[model samples]
Target: MKHLLLGAAALAVTASMALAGGHSVVRMGTEGAYEPWNFINDAGEIDGFERELGDELCKRAELTCEWVKNDWDSIIPNLVSGNYDTIIAGMSITAERDEVIDFTQPYTPPDPSAYVALDAGLDVEGAVIAAQATTIQAGFIAEKGWTLIEFATPEETVAAVRNGEADAVLADKSFLDTVAGTDGLVMLDRMEAIGGGVGMGLRESDAELRAKFDAAITSMKEDGTLNALIAKWEVASQF
Candidate 1:
């Protein structure tokens, strides 16, 4: 439940060293908790839009890749520490994050941040907002000087609202769609656009790897494969 507005700055200070690179198999790190973006399936394997897209990207890059599920709170630290080679999580590209790590051209377009609450008329200005820790939504709340409560995972944020611990939960609209309008929860009409878009996170020293994935993503965008995947996942509007 740490505020990324603060944690991201700390990350920039400490994440100065890069891990030695020479691995034959590239590890793709993800939360595996955010569905439609990345999640653990019935087979207990990583499956979702990023999983599908990442596999194809690896293929195009001619690199062997494997998926690694890491906690969202330490995803970036682990990547810089060489626990993984790349992050394929649904992480928004931001200036604060860019200071600590490198990102490829966005594969997914910018997604709208939305608030979901039990009642449609919740006064957002005075409302207690719940958001997943270290996310753009949480940072946005902190930046706005809103009454913010953060949780370790996306589910916890929704739970905070359902339990009356918060007035509403703010998160990615696509992520909220799976739960919005269910169990008396409704997504508000208002939306906040935060961050640039979702992209692959890499260590600053991994220029070659970053370039490979960037090329692959660019090719996907040019060929409309990326748009097709976006439609299939309903993650965001297509480019």
Candidate 2:
């Protein structure tokens, strides 16, 4: 599989125009591939932590919201291009990403990153590691000077491990749990939480929209509603 490098984000130079005042219908984009956080359920609807959280946020922000499913690799650029007003895809908050898009305060706490493979143990430093493109895990592998194989979606990374295309797949421990413990794949008994909490991604120019969602996220964080959702999805640790 061809792996795209991080420079793909350099295309997100388009500035978002100001949204009209008042609560207009807003569009929320998600990968709909990463489970528990966001995924397509049997009915083919977007269902998961982010779906519920995004809906509640829109209600609290007093905006009519619609869901937009986009491939993981293009989510950010699409948001910058006005394809969506907000990104509720389980996107991590990082300084590199912050330069391209702004983020709301964390809704889900950081998750431990894990190495999982068909083999129980592998040489992380020398083994080929698969990670979803544009994620913290992918960056970590590069920073560690390890061979990194990038995929457009989380499922593809895991599949690479299963297909013996990669030595291991590095991703959120919780996400890997859904695949590892059940798919004959095993977690490497080694892992690390390498980034901050997951948050909503908005265009850098959408300060007003970011603020509105930030306030809504703050409300959730204050009320224990966010904790309930965290437990509900079993995605990661709570704030």
Candidate 3:
């Protein structure tokens, strides 16, 4: 749900700094918060499934790439404003977002959406659901006419459910699984698909760059490298 809304561009100057050796930099922006997809490790580096995948794609494309951490809610806007050249974050390939930015052919297929709650008493149809703002999960809650509580980040949404601010949180099952296992949370019996597949977001002007990554992803798929990464991350859903 953490859709990029351009609130400010004060960091544009720093973001536009060039790479050395006359090599064009392909800065990869990610929300370094969500785990298993992309998250900051103890060493203070972006480390996760997307991290590994991004490096592989960059190597295959022969791009001089670097990771850029951006807040999830502003990720898309920063990319549009040139803070980064690509988004290696776990962004879904949705029609609404496609209108604003181009997406590579999906590397991660759409995983099922699940509802996690502290308990089973809340009526999902009428209960207040927590979702990160501007996400498909948030849209789904709104579409169902459920009272939706919006948060700026996924952690905040899950925290809302823990704090009784929401009856449940709707999110990707892989993500919810991590939180549910340790925090006394539980998945409800409701599960569904909300969006298409997950892909890297790119600027519409970066068609050539998108093609490079797409080709690399296709190669990985053909050789089973992509599935290996998915399985390694325990995000086993495949196209």
Candidate 4:
């Protein structure tokens, strides 16, 4: 749960920048803070499951691509504003987001949402839940009428729970798993499945580009390479 809102101003930019020899240079946008999905490594370069997958997809599509790091809250807007051509971040494919931008065929299966808290017996239903703003998890919490605390980043949500600002922090299981058992945090028993699986976000006008990446994703799913990467990164369930 991370990307959801966008403004009409985002529709201003129409296409990506072109490189020499007429080859399209695609700028892949991402929230580089989500580890295992995308993040900055010790070398100060973008490195993670998405970084690897995006590179492979570009090679398969025969497109020259570069990674662009953007804040999670403005990721969608930046993409629509021509700051980037595609969002390779671990964005869930949801109907709400589909109305603003196109999404490629999902590369990863629907990841289960989990609640992590300091106390194992925390009453999640009535407890104050922390979620990244504009994410499906945040929407879900609000829809449930539960006390919801919104944070700008995933780390902030977890921090809220740690600091007693919230009873629990709800987020993707893959992300929670990394922090569980550290700093007295424990994963709760309840798990909720949210959204349709994660995919590449593209502009509606980039149908041709979407097709290229979709084809590449289909090939990966067929050849078992995508599953291999999923297993390697342990981000989500494989296709």
Per-prediction TM-score, please?
A: 0.92, 0.90, 0.89, 0.93
Given candidate 4, what's the lDDT at residue 76? Answer: 83
How would you encode candidate 4's per-residue C-alpha lDDT over 124-162 as one tens digit per residue? Answer: 998999999888899888889999999898999999988
In candidate 2, what are the lDDT values of residues 38-144, reduced to their tens digit?
89999999999899999999899887899999987777778888888888887777776777778888888788888898878577888999998867788788999
Candidate 3 local accuracy as lDDT?
A: 0.81
Please list the residue runs of candidate 1 whose C-alpha ends up more than 4 Å from where it truly belongs after superposition: 1-21
For residues 36-127, what per-residue lDDT tens digits would candidate 1 score against the true structure?
A: 79889999999999999999999999989999999998888888777888989988787777888889988888888889999899889789
The C-alpha lDDT values of all candidates are 0.85, 0.82, 0.81, 0.87
lDDT of 3 by residue, 1-239 (tens): 22343343522322332222234878999999878899999999999999999999889888878999998777877877778888888888877677677899989888788899988665788788998887778878888888999988899999998888888999888888889855768888888767778899887767778888899999999999999999999653865
Q: Please name the candidate that would achieve the greatest lDDT relative to the true structure.
A: 4
Total clashes in model 2, counting residue pairs 3 or more apart in sequence or in different chains = 0
The positional error of residue 82 in candidate 4, measured at the CA in angstroms, is 1.0
Better candidate by TM-score, 1 or 3: 1
Judged by lDDT relative to the true structure, which candidate is superior, 1 or 4?
4
**Weakest 10 consecutive residues, lDDT, candidate 3?**
12-21
